[model samples]
Target chain A: MRGDVIALDVGGTRLKGAVLDERGHALTTLERPTRATRTPAAVVESILGALADLRRRPQAEQAVACGLVVPGIVDSVGGRAVWSENLGWRDVPLRELAARRIGLPVVLGHDVRAGALAESRHGAAAGYRNTMFVPIGTGIAAGMVVDGRLLDGDGLAGELGHVSVGHEELCACGAKGCLEAVASAAAILRRYRSRSGAELGGTQEVVSLAAAGDTVAGAVWTEAIDALAAALAMASSLVAPEVVVIGGGLSLAGATLLEPLQSRLDSRLTFQRSPRLLTAALGDRAGCLGAGLLARSAMAETVGVR
Target chain B: MRGDVIALDVGGTRLKGAVLDERGHALTTLERPTRATRTPAAVVESILGALADLRRRPQAEQAVACGLVVPGIVDSVGGRAVWSENLGWRDVPLRELAARRIGLPVVLGHDVRAGALAESRHGAAAGYRNTMFVPIGTGIAAGMVVDGRLLDGDGLAGELGHVSVGHEELCACGAKGCLEAVASAAAILRRYRSRSGAELGGTQEVVSLAAAGDTVAGAVWTEAIDALAAALAMASSLVAPEVVVIGGGLSLAGATLLEPLQSRLDSRLTFQRSPRLLTAALGDRAGCLGAGLLARSAMAETVGVR
Candidate 1:
């Protein structure tokens, strides 16, 4: 309980690493680009390098275990990265590799789920037992906590992005009408560019244009909110979470995204409990913080106290 | 653990009572009409009368506890029937009333959730840890088992009935486009009558006519199946249950409902896992059986062995 731990959240483009004490307070944090590492082996090497760098920090001198989380289909129990389209990895035994190299016990988990755990325990969703953490970024996914337990239907429980919102837009997943096809950050930018024949660097640009009274941007943004509300209404109908923590890139839109989305979801619901919608408080550091908690748990389990 | 228990399922129209031995097999079953019991007090008397009748049976000689399940909002842990639109009750302490009269401890639960528990434990959803028991009756509701625990989102989880399925139909709950508005057995009958200008005694009559190649009946049935598939596809995306057990009066349609629903749900999915659709095997007795299980658990708790 007195030792520090090393934590890493390996995303598609960057590795967010942290050294944290047993209480989940970060002692030192670091971020490194993984965009240049194109292959699975290169990504693994980058992860090892990041871990080695963190270990060299004075704060991590007594690090007892490491927690590694990655995007895509992760087999948390098996300590394997099953598949990740963005990170370009499949069936990599990440825990074993890191543990053997770093000489510490390791725990593996899904990045989004880890973020959800962090948010539920210490951020916006804290105090709510049934919570949903939905991150709308390059892609959309949800991490749900029901009855104070994270739902892991074999790592397939929270595919909120893929549920259809009654749209005809084709999704990259070879399906039509997926929420991701219409409401994700990338989807919003793509829709805006195609409809207005104007280029925008990111979804925030479209949000700004919409706020500034651009009709085309307004229409695209409205469509995205509508799709998101439909998906959330469906989620509320099914699980009835007490709080929905909107995270990832689009959540940076703050009230611009949440206000209209909340009203729309409220209008759609009748008998189902309306979940309080809030922006994630931990911002982008949630995954790394959660990874630290996972490492702490691993250490506790080893000491037969968890 | 060695004693029998009395179980009662209180519905809007009837009270189904059962005396069960330790193994959950019904030693004796009885049914009584509650159609004349219009007020909450009258309904309570009807329930007590039914319980008295069941207690007179030889199978109830060693009954130790009673499980009472009612329709509508239930506070299971508080042993209260919070509200029932159907039974015209509000904040009734049914468990205390029943326990005092019967001279035994009592457990209370929601009827649909009880049916789900029974189906998951001993019926269609047996052997599957992640299962959804959706009974499409006069009304539609779901009982979900996630990670081997029944989700009690403050008794507000699993309102699959009210989720919109892209229809314009107005539901009894004052909501438009609800799944219950389009897909419940009652909705199917209403749709058939409004479309065909024919009066049907039951939803099964519409099913029979559809099977006999009536175009209007076929259209109504197809619409119901489409709406169900849409709602279920959404459920799969959210919870990713391993199996979805279709119960209630609609399941009597058997392969007619299951075949097209499975195909339609399959067509809606892209990357999410498809849950196997199965019919409820316990028929109308599921609620009664589940109540017995609840009673058994209460007795086990009293013995400090659960």
Candidate 2:
């Protein structure tokens, strides 16, 4: 099948995109550096350039709708990007711009939420009615699916990383004890390096050292896992999800991460239903696929309403 | 107008009821002791007796459906009381039993959530689309309103009372440092009494003492407010509710509670949307009113589907 929708997952340093068939399967894919500069115009130009690149593809002719997912706050209902610190975007009319450029119906969505939608519908969280998708990359954020639908909360819900967990570390968000400051992939790597005074390549190196019996590495990992457990426990208490899908770079450690994290969450929880913890299935492609799903659903909704 | 629905808010010791007109105004009200006993059967009997008592009233002659709100982990969708430590109810088919006894359509809901629903529809949170109703009476719990709808999370959601706040007191749920253990009205009175070695009559007296410059009482109040601020901050980061309606015993303290709490929450928040914190409206009558709303809505849904 030809691409029936265009999906783009815009990030700080990269713009990943795909043209998806009706089933949301990617027919073709593209990637380019976001070329993020001080000016917001450069970011907008880059986004448009990415769309133009996709339009040159044979599959672009088949797409009737487009989904654009981006980092930071988005008022999806209003089709606006409320803010993105990385892109220096403030209340940019993203959906309208993308729709006009692509000549297709556009759906704007939060990147994490779009990934969560994709995971819930076609990835690890498939078949689960209530799911939380936490992607712990450079930072931690969540995409929640409640009663089998994405929960946007006016583009403000699912900032799991920002929730404080009583840690001593100062977070990038200028808050102390935030889960992201203590447990995110970037945080993990930075903390490990600061503690050991050794320059580590990334979160994977820290995980490997922890697994290989480096006591210092293990301690850092344990603390990160503990903070994550507290946040997850609180989340479960508020809106119990049937499954929690862990994505991002750290989840690549697989059982090394899930095993201890699950035990800590178990100890923290009481009467609340313990959720099934699983690694995300779609890998890095989750965002674009999720964008595809969002695009298709929006198109379907429009058709249904008429 | 005659009573079009019967609504009951069942507590551990009392059954409070109202006969509602089609518009949901209470045509008549009733209350009775639960007479809780050895078996779940006896408790069920007490509930049925309460319904029968209401049925005997002239106002109830026109009732076509009923709504019953109760304390416990309830699967409202499944019509079952999954568990209630207070009433020793386990796997009880509450909606079915009540429907059979009353010869009417029945809707079952969790008490805190019912109150929240009531508040959202007609009380403090009436105009807000996304709100969190946290009623800190003898215990703390939350009723979440997201995207203008109640979030049940399969009946396991909204256990804010049990969420750990890193305090010293152990919760009755067997969890230590829970919000309920440290900040509930019962906790405030008990902690103040323990500190001063005086048997206080209630939370109000403690608040009065604190207002009068009693250092011990003031300390207890400050600690409670701090815990609430942390929990609310976390909740805001995740759900970003436009307003937080605080109900229950502590709310009676009014500005004494809201003032310090608002400041603490303000300091804790980062990029998240700030929520307006207010005392709950509808007072103690919120539960029954919520039940009425639920009953009416259920009836409306039935009518709409047909």
Candidate 3:
């Protein structure tokens, strides 16, 4: 048997774990709160504990390797979590520690990049050699597959959110006019709340309010869409992907977002090829699935013709 | 014995041809006016004639293959010149035709991309796996080396010149505010001439005037540099190349261009990795050297592996 692989995706608020077989089918799944307010060492302990818990499951008995993906700047090759503002960590060697504890080879990856790999292999971006998977959540980040290879420029390549879209809003990164500052899910909700002086539960509520003819909601949503369009237009002109797979929390808006974004991008582009925009097929599971894929590749490299 | 190869770089007004050995050393070189105003067929004929002339030389007697690179949109896989506004051609199967006449396997490539390959192999960006080769001539285009592979997004990946950099000038491609519209050598000269009402001989004269404290010339030069900085900042965010090699006519300005560009890019970036700005080491011969490399790779594939 090729055996299964253990996959873990660690985000700011959640840790999603899965035991996936050769074909990337999840044999077993687990999820838990990250509780990242704890020390970086505590977070590391929690991750190891989750892996141990998953390993105890019957489906993970034959797991050949483990793949762990984390948000923020990751040194994938070095198997280090370089930096994570949400988790308050820097240069933690997660893979080496996990490999020693788990008694299996471990592969480390960036969350967004792993998600992109998963999408390219088994999700909406499958079959497209050049694809950009942009996930708009608390922040926006891009996972680019260029010429059928994931672009990892020392873990700094796919920072679409930080790129200025000619706006004036200040980003958390201390840059002005970042796409994330103006168009992320948190930004949209915050912008709406501040503009209308009304309390909103989430970005979805703002989208709903816009649909129901609320002026502030409509303006906020439109600006977000316009910002997204501007960023995508710049992406198209630079990378020229055949398609862009939109994912994360805000992607749930579906056609409400895709239609206007496509039109806006079309109007902005003159000589550049306009990429077809589609909502992500795998939803939030992409990162976990990508971890599974990473583990599988490492397994293949170890057991096959090296 | 591994044989030599014929390399041809087709520009708007020049056809640069060379016979190079396996080590990429040019044994013989030739250059002639492209006369691109003629029909596409005539252009094709001129290319074929150039190859024939190169092949007849004593140094090219044992040439195994030919690599032909041209400007405009190129389908490297399909071996077709998809489009070239300067050459006035579209969808011309130049590779297959040249192969049939030249009696050698012909590899087609985009001139700038081929130049990037040359730079990656033997020029300024030789050791860096991720590099961007931006040649600022009559127009601006980028040849990106991402993770040691030249990016080819179906001939649409590296149109950095067309990416909007918040300028209002009209571009030849009918796009307003394109980087090329305000920052290209031609654009800089035209803007200077229009503003100063002085008939300057070339871009160098404008640079000289700018150095001599001519306000109009200085403004045009500064604007061009600023626009370049904006475009490069966008590229740095998207690709995060380790180094950016600036080539083409304007690169002759050397430190005058590199110093200001580096500082401006530094100011614009927040969290992105800043790439080292370097001038092209191969000068104008990069494209021909890249063609030779392309031909060498093709030869290796034919004889060594599938």
Candidate 4:
């Protein structure tokens, strides 16, 4: 526990790693293509190779533990990846495998949940006892923090994207009208494409067209904002978090997203306190920083108890 | 602490009281009619008189605390009744007033949340670390228990009634298509009335008619159950609670409600664990028992600590 810890963040299309100090300040970082289509075992090997490369660095001998985070359901208590549709992994003994391979104690967590932990401790949600961290990227998900603790809910919680808001649009999940089907960045692009019959490059292009006063683009953007507001307002009424930290790709829209969304949420709520909406501060590094912090804390706990 | 504590449960139309020991066993219980249309001061006086009469018994002298549970939003952290639409109360310091008059410590809690606490402690949700107690009565609301702790959420959480579930039906809360607008017992009766143009006596009568194979009644029952299941399934995906305890007036429908609701919920969820659905073991007395337990715990915390 004298020096830094190694952290790895696994996403659907990319693998990111970092070596950080005790305070979670990154000393070095690396990124590699996920290539998940190969196999789960190959992905594991890639992660190990990344860890080994980090260990070969000049200060590698200072590392004491390893932390890893991945998308989808994770059984953190049992140290298993319960399921990851994106990673094609189920019941993988991730923590034990990482420990055996790296020869160091390992901390495992859900990617979004770990990002939320990072935000609560060192970024936008710091000082708030209750916060909802929602990341709207290729998909929509939330990590809820209550009473200064992240809610794992036995690893099945934080599936806010699937909460039905009744749009009647077909979702990839085989459900009609889910929030992720209409409000995520990918959904915004899809809606724009369907309405204007012009294949917009991405959500950013739609935002640019809306900024230039294109009616169809504006309508799609407005609907996405409305859908997000509806979901956030309902969540606020139920959880009353002090703040909501919006992250992921769509968040780059900034005030374009927050203004109408806040107004709609305010119109819907009657009795609950309106939570302040803010952008995530950690950006793409949140999950890695969070994993490093978790590893550091785990090492501390082990030593203190001993 | 050596004798029974006084517990009072204030509902929309009735007031129930009980004398209970530290273990929540009732020593004596009483009930009185409540007319909410009466003056608030008169209601308070009536409750005081009932408690005074109960305290006149020989076993009352050793009592050291009192507990009161009431409907609507309560700021337990501030020891104030924030609002009770049913009781016409706003910002009332009921806990302080009750404690001063009774010459003993008093605890206040939301009625449904208290019932949930009781269920988690002694009833269907017992032994579960995470539970959601949803009471679908005249209205729908929930009490959430996470990691064995009741989430008060600054007195604004647990408004499960207002969560939207795709229904376009207008709600009394002014929101179109809230869960309560479609799934509550009153909502079921309203749906039946609107469909058949016939006045049903109550939810029980509607259930009996449906059981007798009345088509209109069956349709109404089925719609309400579907709406409830939809909302509960969404909640299950987000919270992943170990158990969902159903209580209140509509729960009296028993298997007629449980069977269809469970099947519909199972069909909707894909990744989350299916929680055990069970009837609340504690009857109407749950609120008072939970209030007593709260009072006892608060007193012990305050007096036992050096």
Candidate whose lDDT is highest: 3
Instruction: For model 1 chain A, give the 10-residue run with minimal summed lDDT.
Output: A297-306
lDDT per residue for candidate 3 within A1-306, as digits (tens), equals: 287999999988899999998888899999998864588888998899999899889998989889999999988889999998789898999999999888888999989999999888888989999899999999999999988889998888899998877888888988888899889999998888788788888888988888999999999999999889888888898889999999999999999999999999999898688999988988888999999888887777777833
Off by over 4 Å in 1: A298-306, B55-58, B298-306
Q: For each candidate, what TM-score against the reference? A: 0.95, 0.97, 0.98, 0.93
Model 2 agreement with the true structure over A11-59: per-residue lDDT tens digits: 8788999998888777889999887576888898889889878977997
Candidate 3 overall lDDT versus native = 0.90
Q: Candidate order by TM-score, highest to lowest?
A: 3, 2, 1, 4
Better model by TM-score, 1 or 3? Answer: 3
Model 1: per-residue Cα lDDT over A1-306, one tens digit each: 668889999988889998988778889998989756478899999998898899888988889889998888877778888888788888999889988888888999888889999999999999998999999899999999988888887777888998888878899888888999989998898888888888899888998898899999999999999999999998998888999999999999999999999999999887678889999999999999989877787678778885
lDDT tens readout by residue for model 2, B189-283: 88987888998888888878888999998899889999999999888988889999999878998998898899899999988987999999898
Checking candidate 2 for backbone clashes, the offending pairs are none
- Pairs that collide in candidate 3 are none
Clashing residue pairs found in predicted model 1? none
Q: How well is each residue in B1-306 modelled by candidate 3, as lDDT tens digits? A: 288999999988899999998788889999998864578888888888999899889988889999999999999999999999888898999999999888999999999999999998899999999999999999999999988889989888899999888777889998787999889999998998798787887788888888999999999999999999988988999899989999999999999899999999999997688999999999989999999988888778878843
Clash count for each candidate, listed in order shown: 0, 0, 0, 0
Tell me the docking grade of candidate 4: medium
Which of the two candidates, 2 or 4, achieves a greater TM-score against the reference? Answer: 2
Query: What is the RMSD of candidate 4?
Result: 2.6
Candidate 4 residues lying further than 4 Å off, grouped into runs, are A1-4, A55-63, A195-197, A297-306, B1-4, B35-37, B48-56, B300-306
**lDDT accuracy of residue A68 in candidate 3:** 95
Runs with alpha carbons beyond 4 Å of true place in candidate 3: none
Query: What's every prediction's RMSD, in angstroms?
Result: 2.1, 1.9, 1.5, 2.6
